[model samples]
Target: MADRQLRTVLEGGGFFEGPRWHEGTWWVSDFYRHTVSRVAPDGAETVVVEVEQQPSGLGWLPDGSLVVVSMKDHRVLRHADGSVSTYADVTEHCGGHLNDLIVDAQGHVFVGDFGFDLMGGGAAATASLKRIGPDGSVSVAAEELQFPNGAVITPDGGTLVVGETLGNRYTAFDLGADGSLTNRRVWAALGPEVTGTTVDEVLGQLVVAPDGCTLDAEGRIWAADAVGGRVVRVAEGGQIVDEVAAPAGLGVYACMLGGDDGRTLLMCCAPDFYEHNRAPVREAVLVATEVDVPHAGRP
Candidate 1:
């Protein structure tokens, strides 16, 4: 495939994440701005809601209500009829702040946590992935993950693939009907298993730090290489099938396949991922490029 031309879709975000295509618009979470906004194809934008505790992942319930991850307080919030309320509180189950999430068709939300004080420069530790049922109940879906960030469910809804930023791999789980996760395995090994305890050590061993990602119709994953300045499409067994590089001096943290045709690969770009740098600035941008395959399965 030829290198796709990248174009700016939206700019001036205070560190954007969780890019999603819904109802003919692009929905994204701006970390420093403390708000979720919707962007149209023509570059117009509208703020959806403000998450005072900081918002990360986003998904919709079967009824069309929006559910977002409140990172700081470890809560999942629901937005409907212009009001936001707590949907689930998973603080007891999290070791650190929540990061990203994926909502299944049945409204079962699977969310991941930081596993350590990332911005505080703490050592790396394993964390659990929590599943929030449609009834607002929370439970542990999987455990001992190395900073699980982005996630996706298969088209049949039988499997869940999650990116482990510190582990340099994508892990898979058998998503049970009752919202249970079993049969844990490595979906893709981006690099050798990282056994480092410190953030610096882990960063040194990582070849591709997968962050927020999306699934394609061909069963491949388009994941932001958080430290690589690009988004890579990884097939099963960790082969990089394709990639889209970010502009010089910037890093791509998250991406989603969304557009009128679903082939637009929307990337969240910024100077860096540090809170001190991104939170006080608005250099983050949402850029788009065409891809061969459209999106498929749960977000």
Candidate 2:
């Protein structure tokens, strides 16, 4: 596939992640800014809420309430009618900081965690995926995951695909009728998983570190390669069919297939991401490229 041209849609962000198109608008979170915002088609940005801890993922509940992931505190905050409250707190269940999340049509929120002290330069450890039900019940959805970063649910809500950033693959699970995750398998192995490798060696050997992803109508996943500096569209069995290379000196962190027609591939780009380097200076941006397939799936 030919490399598509990426155009900056919104700029001057501390670090953007979890891009989603909902209710005819694009929603995202800036980590350092501790805010969730909505971006208009014309590139205008409106802050939906200011989170004190930090926000990563954005989703909506059944009654039109906004559900956001508070990263540092490991809480899901629900905003309804201009009011904010804790939907669920998973601090005790999560191994480290929370990363990203997706809410199903039935109001089941699947959240990921860091599993280890990433910013503190700790060793890589297995993580787990947690699910929060509508009634504020929390449980471990799946266990021993290698740094699950982003996830998406099929339109029918039958399957959940998650990007395992450290595992170098996209893992999948069958969503049962009772909200249980079973039949865990690798949906796509973008690269080999290096076991017993140091964190630096593992990072250096990754061909494509699948960070965040969105699904298209044809069942293809457009995933941002966190270390590869590109957003790749992968078909079944880890085959990369298309891609949009990031600009020089930038790393692609997250991506979503959205826009008026749903063909715009939105990518989050930053100079670098670390606890110390990323500040409120707004070096990150949301860039987009047009594709042939339209988006189809739940955030």
Candidate 3:
């Protein structure tokens, strides 16, 4: 297949990352703004949760509850109805800020931490990947990630792929029924310079579409590249087959592969650099493009 591309479905921001499609809308997290937004099909956006602690990753539970990774605070927040509360506690164990996450069909939330203060508060290779059960129990899943960021459980829930941003590749693992990971290996590699991110932001992590990753029904895994200035698309075996350019300097963060026909590409874009002295902004764009694939995972 030819490489996929995207147009300006929308724009404007200090930075943007993490695009997830669920319940008829594209949900994204604004890092600097510390808010989670829901976007409409025509590019309109509405902020649903204004989490002050730099929200990055998002997930859902079997009962329709929402969970979010608060990067600055190192806690997970669970949203039910309209209220929020602690979903899991990891401060005493990891002692690092959480970044991105991927929830499996079994109600297990896999989360990653920075390991050290990357923005300058501290320095240590403490990066790791952890997991949280639906009942609020937290546990360690993997240790010593270079920089584990975006992640996803394959369509059949058989494998979990994590984006090691610093390494510029996707780390694949065999999934267990109990939500544990095994046989750690590199499934896809994106050389430091090769990406489709807008702006100068480095391509941190990526997501795999649900509808086709396992069967080829549109089987594809897409990464939200930061420095490459676009979203890069890959086939089943993990190859950079194509890319979609955005106006935002190629600092693409994350994306979702789903829409009405199960093929809309939703993205969070920024012009790179999170404004002189600030962190990246989670900008907006309702529908980045129409991919030839449908997203896997929850509604």
Candidate 4:
């Protein structure tokens, strides 16, 4: 299922979001250009840290330092040797801003938020996923969830999946060797159970809004149907099998699966998911293609 033919590994961003290929290159997060760059697989770019309470997801910490996800001050900065600080504040357990995170392999992060006030329209509550620890401390590793953005951590780390952008679904848990998340379930549901509550009545019963995700090597899950511009690949129970779409007028939201044999899948396009038209536009982009499993967990 490798629908290859979509290159363009970087562009005038302003929206992009937590991608991550690590050590080799690709890390990302731009939300209105508050920076956190690093691309280079021929596209050259490099900025790596400017945050200003904007950068989303991104991980690393097992002494390699990097952390990020300062999404509007809910904190989690770290960056080591180069200096950035605030390794975990959780702003008293967020309820609106912070979004997206994942960092297991003993560093254990797992963040998420946007339980309400989504871009200021308000009314769509329920969110929680916290976990920080590794000496930074912060807890509440799972709760109602509903907008928990993106997350992953498996490769023997004992599962953690997560993507519930407004709750079209992805869920899953049970990782506790100290990170604690416990059984929980529903690792794929892309369609029912939205039950509206504003935000245009739960985005008019979204059919597949599960934004930002990864995890391949057959365990499936590519997800990023953020409004269905497309990415889907899910396979744990709500079977979608494969999908990609999102090149005309763009709108992919997020995706990863890195390169150098990980079967690259990147993608993060834009043109929608408004924060006032992507915070005053630079248009956003970071595409790639080629897929057939090869990336397995944690990011």
Candidate 5:
């Protein structure tokens, strides 16, 4: 178990999310900056691609090229050998803006949508979990999800788990060979879902706004509690087994279990998440803390 002590890995970011540790570096997306960047072990950052429509989730293809979620346009963009292009267009199939995504070993991508106009102020609505195959074809993997965000696939490739932010729980699905998701069930339920427009009202009802998360070698989940300013490691049954809180004025928007040995838990800290507030500032930072469990599973 770790405490609240966290050290800065990188700073001056504009609302970071979708962190992935791959190929000896940390890749993440800056929502406001509209860029996907990679941070080295020594905290150096290099912009991989500048997405015009805004970038959220990040993954890679089988050919080692980068794939990013274009949030506002509801598209997935691929960057290969220094060129960016559309990999899939999911606008007609999606209700709202697209969020985070996970790419399996076979290059199958599972992505989530917002379901409502979150930034512009809309009522809570159900969303869809979409899957994009290697051939650039799209399909609805699942539906009626309440704000599906971060997602991860088990190392054995048998299961896929996603964080439903508004639902206060993580949902699991059986991943079939044909890219179909089945056997949907609640993997962890921190609290019941709450519907509200104001921040206080929504926060009051949520036990934990489970945001971006990563899986550890022990089969546990390290989920960022967006409203609680803490990153909690939850066991299979939704029990809070371990946690690490951020300092005042900082909230953990996303997290990844990564490092040379995968024992480092990287926290994406930001001052706030509101579009009006966070879009104008560069107060976000990348912080790291040592953990006992190393990482396991897909991006």
Candidate 6:
């Protein structure tokens, strides 16, 4: 059990989410800014594409093409050879915004949506999960999730876990060879008496709405909660053994376990999201941790 209390290593920009570590660099999205950029090891930032609609979720294809979730459009877009194109359009089905995503080792992209207006009064999480093929086709994978956010797969690629934010539950499913889910069951729930967002460092600020979750090779779930402002390490049987604080900020939107050895955690923090201006002061922040746990999954 390893833990640390860290601050934002990099800051400034729009509302940030979807932090993906690829090719020894960190890639994240500024949702409101409509841009997908890469944060280098030296802290240099470069915009890969300024996508249409707000880009929330991001992943890579087997061929190295970039796949993104277009929030406002409620569609999936793929980028290759410096060109952006639509992979799937689901505006009619979702009727809202696509929030975050994770792809499996088999190249299945799992996308989540708000199912309603989260910031402006849509209180419910209206989505099942959607699985997009490598060719950009889409289909419903599972239903009944309330604001599904971040997800991850086991290193063995046998398990799939999703964080249901407003629903206050983390669910796990079996990853089938055909990319279908089986035996969907609750993994953990946000209870009043629970402690520590991380399995280590017992900082007992717990709440409902576990926003984003990632799995370590050590088989731990690092869950980030928007309401709690803490990322918790959930062990087997729903125990929070460690915790990490989100510096001194108003809110913690999402988190990723990346970096050399996978211990470096990057967070998307914002003071507030219910703003009329929509331009965030410091949209995304990058934080590094001493623990080395590589990210496992598609995002």
Best by lDDT: 1
lDDT of predicted model 1: 0.93
The alpha-carbon deviation from the true structure for residue 15 of candidate 5, after best TM-score superposition, in angstroms, is: 0.6
Q: Sort all candidates by lDDT, best to worst.
A: 1, 5, 2, 4, 6, 3
Tens digits of per-residue lDDT for model 2 on 139-159? 999999988988888889999
Regions of model 2 farther than 4 Å from truth:
none
Candidate 4 residue spans exceeding 4 A from truth: 1-19, 24-56, 59-65, 69-73, 79-94, 101-112, 117-164, 167-195, 198-204, 213-222, 225-255, 265-299
Per-residue lDDT tens digits for candidate 5, residues 9-74, read: 998888999999999999989998888998997899999899988899999888998889999999
Residue 8 C-alpha lDDT in model 5: 92
Question: What TM-score quantifies how close candidate 5 is to the native fold?
Answer: 0.96
TM-score of each: 0.98, 0.97, 0.82, 0.32, 0.96, 0.89
Estimate every model's Cα lDDT from 0 to 1.
Answer: 0.93, 0.88, 0.66, 0.85, 0.89, 0.74
Q: Report RMSD for candidate 5.
A: 1.4
Clashes of each: 0, 0, 34, 0, 0, 18
For all predictions, the C-alpha RMSD in Å is 0.8, 1.1, 5.3, 18.1, 1.4, 5.1
Candidate 4, 251-279: lDDT as tens digits:
89888988789888898989797789888
Top candidate by TM-score: 1
lDDT of 6 by residue, 1-299 (tens): 45575755567766777887888988888876778999886678899999868888888777778889888888888899988998888775683578788877778888888777655554444577898877667889988776678888887778888887766578889999678999998888666433322312122333656776677777878777777776778875678878777767656777778877777877777775554544645455666565556666545
TM-score of 1: 0.98
Query: What would the per-residue lDDT of candidate 3 be over residues 202-233, giving only the tens digit for each residue?
Result: 32332331111111145556776655656677
Clashing pairs in 5: none
lDDT of 1 by residue, 12-60 (tens): 9999999999999999999999999999988899999999999999999
| lDDT score, candidate 3 | 0.66
